[model samples]
Target: MKITVIGTGYVGLVAGACFADIGNEVWCVDVDQTKIDKLKQGIIPIYEKGLEPIVNKNFQEGRLHFSTNLLDGFDQSQFIFIAVGTPSNPDGSVDLKYVYAVAEEIAKNLKDYKLIINKSTVPVGTGKQLRDFIDQKIKERGINVDFDIVSNPEFLREGNAIEDFMNPDRVIIGTESIRAKEQMNELYSGLFKDAEPRIIFMDVRSAEVTKYASNSMLATKISFINEISNLCEKVDANVEMVRLGVGADKRIGYSFISPGIGYGGSCFPKDVKAIINTGNEYGYDMKLLKAVELINETQKAHLFDKIQNYFDNKKDGLKGKTIAIWGLAFKPETDDMRESPSQVIIRKLVEGGTKIKAHDPEAQNEAKRLFKDIETSIEYFDDNYECLKDCDALALLTEWNIYKQPNFQLIKKHLKNPIIFDGRNQYRPSEMKEMGFDYFSIGR
Candidate 1:
């Protein structure tokens, strides 16, 4: 099968590489010449675990190709995937200009029958809209060609995109055409060697809403747990214990209930807002999701407030204090900083004149780019322990693999004061107290 994935972003690159790894000839097309050049030279733009090696191997093996010209990909591929960015607009609506542009370009170049699959998270009815637009465009050009649009939203996690793609729990295909369904089944069947995938066939609108609804459900769980974590703190209870006790139930699993500062990434925040925007546009209000969004916003600063209240002094008292941050990215194993809570926390700390020393295994450079305006008050470090040197206390933000069981003795030795602020609740409270360090964790 010859597949073309447009836009070499996170979704585009990962999907293209994984498809090629499965023996399909794939072309990863992007308008940015520099990005395509870098991809051709084995330079990956994103820091997803296990992504670079597969991309390099597949590229070297002549299965994966990167190009700036969409014509190159469009002319030779049987299946075209629109993996471009559909970012949020100012009013929280989906800004789908990129997806529309790609669809229009495909319409203009529709020389024969092609199965157009949309892998980007989009609003409901978008597939129908694109189908109509393409039909009109092709008719205006006096070309009597046929193309079937299918909604195939991606559910790949950032850190585990490759694994999720290769072994997805289920794949959703949205098209009424039996031929289109068969085409999609054949393409995705390569992912499973000996077993059939759990492919859910549904209407186009349902498939589009599934992507947003899935993220919104996870967002609700995150906000619900954070809200409960706050109440646990007030009632002198531990959220970790509550989570363990509650998660034991068969119905409610402990998937997205980890109480942290908040959920932040490219997906959760954007999808929640986009769904709410979609509801409002149709004269419907998603009240629960609205509260979920609000709670997530409040939770982002929950740890910062704890750090400030420990001193119980005015902002002037924090003017000269230096704090060490263990993580800067939203989560671990990725360098994405879009809407990271570290941004809100560090911005507040800097506004109060607090200096910060931050360390993240992969996000330090991204942190540098994100916090460049306030770089004077912040220092970047490669070693997590080295980041704690001469700081007032250590504030652990993202729960990276290495930051789990750190050397508390070294932490105490490095910090000017034996204090720690753990947002992820990585350590036990009793253990921290026994270790002779003042430790603060979320809801425990």
Candidate 2:
């Protein structure tokens, strides 16, 4: 199987590397020459666990190749995957310029019959739109080149992308052409040989919607739990106990139910907005999704309010206070800070005339870049304990593994006040009270 994956972003790069690892000759094509060059030299752009080693091994073994030229890969490739980014517009709609541009480029270079797969997360009916666009371009060129478009959206979590790819819960292939389906089955035959057949074939539109709906549902769960946590706080109920009771039901197995500041990262926020906008475009309003978005936005500020209230009770407020922030990334095991709740909390804290000392094992440089405007108001520390030194209170935002169990005695030694606001519920309230520290968390 000779395949060409356009775009070297998370999805494209992971798919290309994994395909090559499964004995397929893969050409990872990118428009950026510098990115292609770096990839060729074993320099990966992103930090996905278990990705670099596979890419390096496959490249060295002559199974994987990198190039800036899109046309170069078309010569021997049977499948061309468009894995470009669909960034969210200000109006909550997806910007499909990159997707359309890739379609036009592929149309111009088509030499023979090829299976064009949309590996990017796109709105419903985008597969048909791309197919129509390519057909129009081919007709204008007076060429008889044939191609079939299939929507094969990816479902890889950021930190566990490689594991998800190699052992996918299910593989979706969307197309009506039997020939195209047979070819895809053949290409993936080796990878699914030992596993129970988990290939799901569907219409192109359904496949496109599946990606958005799946992500939005997960986001909904997070927001729903956060909302319940807020209610629990008002009613003097412990969200942790409520979560345990609710999640004990087999129908609602405990995933994404943990009450946190909010759901953030590249996918959930954009996908929720995009889906809502998609609904509006079709004369339907996604009321539930809109509420989900609103709740998530409110939840991001929940921790900041707690910090302010804590200081307000002490007759000082956040003004002139130095707060220690543990974790800058949206979640742990990755450096992505896009739409991170920590960003929202930090920005609000800075607006209240507070100084911040933040630390994350992997996101320190990223945090520095994100908070450059507030450089005078915040400081980044290489060590977690160093960030806590002389701070009034410690705010645990991202639930990194290292922050789960820490040197509490040392934390008590550094902070001017023995106060902790845990956004991720990393510590038990009873234990914190026993240890003689003021601990605040989501809900109870």
Candidate 3:
């Protein structure tokens, strides 16, 4: 199959690479000439594990290509995938400007019958809106062409995107047309070659809702665990143990139950807000999701409170403190820092007149961009131990492996005070107490 994936963002790039790896000729089209050129030279713009090698290999093998010319991609492809970004509006509705713009462009240049897949995470009924928009444009131009809109939302997470794309839990196709279904089945033939891949067929609206509902449920789980972790701190219980006990239940099974500062990344925050806003538009409020959102917001502030409380109750009150942060990325294994809880914690700490030194394995450059305004107030360290030197205390904001089991002896020798505020619960409180250091963590 010859496929054209539009927009070249995270989802687009990953999907294009994975499709090409499965023996399809994929043209990853982007409006940004710079991005297209970089990709053409095998310079990937994003940081995803196992993506660069696959994309580069496929490009070298002549299975993948990049282009800024939409007509070139359109003319050579039988399937067009719209994998653009749908950033959330302030009101929580998904911004459809990019989706609409791509649809209009495709309508203008589409030559023959093509299966247009909505691979972007869009709102319910967006397929109908796109169908209507394309049809109106085609009629206005008095051009006779045929195209079918199929909703095929992606469920790839940031860190493990490559594996997820290759071995999807399920592939969704939202179309009633038998011809469209057969074409999609053929496109996904690689996955079904070993065993029959589950093909879910539904109306386009239901298909769109599945993407939001799936992400929103995962986000809700993260918030629920964080909320429970907060309560565990008040009740003198360990969240890790509780998680183990609860997760042992066959129904609960542990996936998104890890307690942390908060959930962040490109998908969860935006999708939860968008779904809540969708409910609001129908004259119904999503009270539970509202609580979930509030809990997550407050959880991000919890780390700041822990640091402040530790200071105030102790001899000092952060008057002349230098805190070292272990991780700056929203989560481990990705360079993405969008909506990172560490950003909020670091900004609040700096605002309170404390100096911060932070280090992440891969997110330092990305973090530097967001913290440019406070560049003078913070220091970016190449080595995790470098940040630990001469600091009053250490805060583990991310669960990077280097920070998991560190040289406590070295840390005690370097810091002015051996105080640790672990946001990710990377350390056991009993062990820290035995080490003769003041330690704090989520839950216990």
**Regions more than 4 Å wrong, model 3:** none
TM-score of each: 0.98, 0.98, 0.97
Q: List the residue pairs that clash in candidate 3.
A: none
**lDDT (CA) per prediction:** 0.91, 0.92, 0.89
Candidate 3, residue 260: lDDT: 89
Weakest ten-residue segment in model 2 by summed lDDT: 187-196
Candidate 1 at 433: error in angstroms? Answer: 1.3
lDDT of 2 by residue, 1-444 (tens): 899999988899999999999999999999889889899899988778899999999999998999988877787999999999999999999999999999999989898999999998899989889988999999999988888999898998988899899888888888999999998888767677854377888889999999999999999999999999999999999999999999999999899999999999989999999999999999998999999999999999999999999899989788999999999889998888999999999999999999999889888888888889999999989889988999999999999999999999999999998999999999999999999999999999
Q: lDDT tens string, model 1, 1-444?
A: 999999899899999999999899999999999888888899998899999999999999999999988888688899999999989998999999999999888988999999999999999989999999999999999979988999999999999999999999889999998999988888888898643548888889999999999999999999999999999999999899899988888798889889999999988999999999999999999999999999999999999998888755534467789999988889988999889999999999899789999999998888888888998999988888989999997899999989999999999899998989999999888899999988899987
The lDDT leader among the candidates is 2
Residues 1-444, candidate 3: write the lDDT tens digits: 899999898899999999999899999989899988898888888788999999999999999888887777688799999999899998889999999999999988877899999999998888998999999999888988988999999998888899888888888889877889889888887755743447788878899999999998998999999989989988998899999999999898899999989999888999999999889888889998999999999999998998998888886787678999999989888889998999899999998889998899989898888999999989989988878899999999989787889999988988889999888888888889999999988887
Clashing pairs in 1: none
- Candidate 2 RMSD to the correct structure: 1.2
Candidate with better lDDT, 2 vs 3: 2
